[model samples]
Target: MFGRGFTLSLSVFFTLFIVFLYGPTVSILVLSFQGPNGGLTFPMRGFSTFWFESLFDGVGVIDIWGAFGRSIRLGLVVMVLTVILSLMAGLAFRKRFLISSFLFYATISSLIVPSIVISLGVALEFRIIDDAIKVFGDNMGIQWVVDDFRTTMGLFSSGLGAQLTWTLPFGLLIMFAVFNRFDPSYEEAARDLGAGPWQTFREAVLPIIAPSLIGVALFGFTLSYDELARSSQAIGGLNTLPLELRGLTTTVTDPTIYALGTLTTAVSFLAISIFLILFALLRRRTNKPSSSKRSTL
Candidate 1:
């Protein structure tokens, strides 16, 4: 809608904006590799991966690799669940359901709630249930497993739930944005071609909206991986990467935290790259003339 001059100015502005935003992240990444004797600021003494290796460093109760693995696993589960549920909810929202409006607003409310409050609720609810489980174990002789499950694997349970509370709204909102641009005639054509509901969705609708699904998955994974607030209490006995990083603040006075931040940022960047590659490939595949004619929804 603007002239070429305005367009060029906007482009330059965004370019500078991106650089401004990523400048600190780039600095952290560089500092992450600071040498053994190097301070956190600058003037590198040498270079080494000592900080990375010292993540656990037999330091304390923290298990760096274990927490990292838990975070990855939880992020994947949350991503998959978010994509599926958001797509289903989006489709359902288009129909005249009995409680569609109620459900939509409920989803919105979850987004509006403070992360800490939601986390507290999750923790309290789990505590109550665990207490009940303890009573049951006391009587029925199933004590060991119930006693320390939180320390061992509570993230997959309560932690995943807490992450979902935040992720699902994002997924649903992305689905809404995607469905906004969707043309229903594509689905109608698939149905006209004798495609069953599932078949139509699989062959037609999904391929068209695949990019947005990737977006939802991307959101879910990143948010869950990087989440600190809700995850603080909801993660139960064991900590995730963010919690580990926070715990390190008091004891760690080196580039180790920078290394951790760099590692996390790399993983996040890797995820983004993979999703972008997949999204591009899907777009290209669906954009092909012959394929588009038959498969584009």
Candidate 2:
């Protein structure tokens, strides 16, 4: 399918895409170093790390550290939970069940649905949950759901739900592809070699797919880290980095916002680098030729 015509057209398209992707990144990185007296957009007013220093020192109006910390914590939580749950769901999907078709469609549906719609549904569901809890508490004469309960739930419930709607579909699909391409003979061979199920997965399956698992985790973390629409109506009390960054857009007229974007992008790159290193190590460890395949020295 890759004819000369296709190659030429694809090359142009790919080049344009790369430019589109990296243009904002480069702009943000450069502008983030604007001098203390710089304007929002280019040309360079001056070159300084004043804005970046302002990041740690809170040069802007909003709580940069607090919002940043919240975003990191939420992303981490989502990453771990997404990896484990999606792996389980992916494996479960391998075996046919009574509602397998329904579950598959439901999982796929989450991705096709608009983020705003899912966010709205999560918000409404949490509201219903709060109301139901109140009614049940009143009937049982239990005052356990104090303001604390409401506060915690407000921060976590809808936010978590909304984010899961976004992350789970992606994780599930990745795992589905991983499993579909997996060779069952490997597992059977492991079993024949007297390895238990846990042993088989640990020493056989896991090492092979560890990189993809890392990829899903990265996707989960980054998705939740930058998520705005889901956390827009879902998160209460505390705003994430993206939301606070949005707040900066209205209140501040400097490149500090670009600094924030740069910081986040740097964090994403760092995470990606770390995952790649781990993946490389795993690949090296698992890529050794088998004893039978090894050549005599």
**Which of the numbered candidates is closest to the native, going by highest lDDT?**
1
State TM-scores per candidate: 0.87, 0.89
- What digit string (tens of lDDT, one per residue) describes model 2 on residues 1-297? 789999999999999999999998898799999888887888888899998887777954678898888889889999999999999888888899899899889988988888778778777777787888877777877767633356334445668778888899999999999999999998898899888988888777887788889989988999999899877888877788888887777787778778888888899899889888887876776687666322210
In model 2, which range of ten residues has the least summed lDDT? 288-297
Note the clash tally of each candidate: 0, 0
Q: What's the TM for model 2?
A: 0.89
lDDT of 1 at 43: 75
Q: Which pairs clash (backbone N, Cα, C closer than 3 Å) in model 2?
A: none
lDDT of 1 at 191: 98
Off by over 4 Å in 1: 1-16, 56-61, 136-153, 291-297
lDDT at 236 for candidate 2?
A: 72
Computed on alpha carbons, the lDDT of every model, listed in order, comes to: 0.85, 0.83
